[model samples]
Target: MRMLRYCSLLALVAALAACSSVPGGGPVSQTKGEYKVGNPYKVAGKVYVPKADPHYVAEGMASWYGPKFHGRKTANGETFNMNALTAAHTTLPMPSYVRVTNLENGRNLILKVNDRGPFVGDRLIDVSRRSAQLLGFEKQGVTRVRVEAVPGPNARPATVFARNTPAPATSPVEQKKAPIVVASARPAPVFTPEPAKKDEVVVQPLEAEPDSPATASENIYVQIGAFSDKLRAKMVADDIRHVGQTLLELVDINGQKLYRVRIGPLPSKARADETLGRALAWGHNTARIVLD
Candidate 1:
């Protein structure tokens, strides 16, 4: 009876050992899928405050990460997959959803923001390889995009203010049209070149005849830098001149004069996007598309 009891105890111990041994001897990490409002986290000396409710909208350059980071743990404890439609954002809550729109090609998709990253310059979000492919920016490595949060099911409705009462309607005769007045033409302004200081580059504006009514359309430019001093703006323009034809324009914003360095009056949005990607690669990370 003692021998039989010893054999039974040994068998029970073997069974317990078998149950505890995982396939590869590595413990599996539990993935947290619930929404979490994380505390303020600092990366590269910048503090990012995570928002509990999804109410964020921003536009900037985006980049993607691939095989090097595959299978690693994400910010929310989930396994990272390069093939998954997931992304990493700095300030949005973990395990949240966002709608990313590629401003260049107009291709848009929804992706889960499950990680944190892209601590590089001025990049708004870092998406997975699969997400980049879907957004049509995989080959270029970077593109300008607009990101907005998609509210979850339990999200509260946005507050709406009541509209003011409308004014009383008037009869057609009471709203008679006013007489049209003809305006006089003014003399064209003279163009004078500004004096340049030593070691300062001066970029002249391109001359063109007055545009006809049939050819009128808004021109778009990629603004790389704006500075209060023309010499500083010229220095930046000289540094980035190899990217494309660089131009300088004087702009007034909020009563402050600024010299803006721009890339082009790019013909189309697609071309502008391609140039934007190249600019980012050349270290002009904060370059952005502007409509004039």
Candidate 2:
């Protein structure tokens, strides 16, 4: 009788473990499928990001990402742990909080925006697997969402005042607008670059001697703006020249006139990086490290 009772207890424990939720933890993760979906932010041309806006709402597609980017670091220095409740937005002040609601089901979840993106059309929000699951989109991967900026303590504080409440009206014009379509959800290829051709030669060089001091190499040149008009290119060139004791070079690429803005002919890549960092730290995203 003692042996039989022990076996029964063991079976019960195994059954309970089989029913667990998170990937290896429970059956829900396995039954629902892994999170390998990617949400890319699609932006057309350039965008003007506002400093701070209290209320912002965008009616567009929502998507999720998971698995592949699991341990990678985000642009804001946070780990991309897909299991966690987090998200990515094009621009919302790094680490700002948001509330995402599934318009269809009315399900809601809050997430921290640590990275930037979702460059597709007017799509507003990009969420993680856990957040997506909680918002009730686990199976579908992507869903129609209404994303709203959740006010934080540091945000502007004001009082609520009553205004003329407009009645909810369903007009033919409103109904005629086509519904936003959420694309297929899948993980984005982050580390992968363009593939090499079959005839491409692979060079394996001996490692540099550890004791030898590193020598200075070629200067990295990044082109800020390449324009057809030579005069317009000079205008941007003049704006960035004084920032760093940097020089600007104008070169014609193809047949079009091009103006290339350079940060260095500096002593080394470190000095170049230091100079580049300073410009960006002072709010210069347009400046990029151009490598030949």
Candidate 3:
């Protein structure tokens, strides 16, 4: 993490002054490619408990790392390849697959998360230079993106077919109590890791994605919760709806009107994170900050 921060500062200076080489620039390091799910750690005062959260998904600003740390060792012991479709993340296990969508140009791709970081205030995954190019955000320095975990190689049927990020997270405890209403398109029950194979962790090489782009997205909206019932959505909206422009938006999906409690357009990623964390404290664990 310290190395990441040092490289970041150098990268900034290089960009501002257009210098070819900067003295005391971070050293180009080697990659460590091993598979690992490290212990919970702190970066810049934020605690990130690394776990194989199969349901992990997030949306926030994304930045790229290249050149200076081009050959550095990643968290998993893999050699960092700035040209490869690789990425660094905060909490995802090393060598995992994740689908990252660039909200700016609507370009998306599957990247291998093999390191930890972009550790810069609420920024999500830190893509390699090649990934940023493929996702159409290389020249921009940063862009809003949505990233969701994907099944790694040799994954079981349950893992491969698990619900995507859009689905809400409802545990059995919440289901029996029914304290919160859910969308009609309810996803399969929350995926609990099998107790027998709990320690299993696997990964595979990623195939390069095609250069297909969708329509571009705009603005940042922190969606706190979604529900088929307007009243239930409103109840959540009233509970943790303090920051930004908190409102209950009605969005139509598959012939149904789902009430979405959201706060946006957030001015920056830090603001979005604040809104998201507040919502989580109110029990909206599925709250996500998105660009759309």
Candidate 1, clashing residue pairs?
A: none
1 or 2, which is superior by TM-score? Answer: 1
Q: TM-score for every candidate vs. truth?
A: 0.42, 0.37, 0.43
Candidate 1, position 25, lDDT: 34
Residue 12 of model 1: what lDDT? 100
Off by over 4 Å in 3: 1-32, 153-292
- lDDT per residue, candidate 2, 1-292, as tens digits? 9999999999999988877533333112211223222233335774636233447667778988889788887755667867666788776655655666677665555566676677776667788886675566778978898766765312221111001212225532243322212123223212222332332211112112221222454345332433445455455455555434444444433332333445544555555544443343222324444443
RMSD to truth, every model: 23.4, 22.9, 20.9
> For residues 102-193, could you state the per-residue lDDT of candidate 1 as single tens digits?
78876556667888888999999999996786568899999999887875312221211011212225522344322222122222123333
Q: Give the CA lDDT, 0 to 100, for residue 259 in model 2.
A: 39
Of 2 and 3, the candidate ranking higher by TM-score? 3
Sort order, lDDT high to low? 1, 3, 2
Q: Which 10 consecutive positions of candidate 3 have the poorest summed lDDT?
A: 154-163
| lDDT over C-alpha atoms for residue 31 of model 1 | 49
Q: Candidate order by TM-score, highest to lowest?
A: 3, 1, 2
Cα-lDDT of candidate 2: 0.50
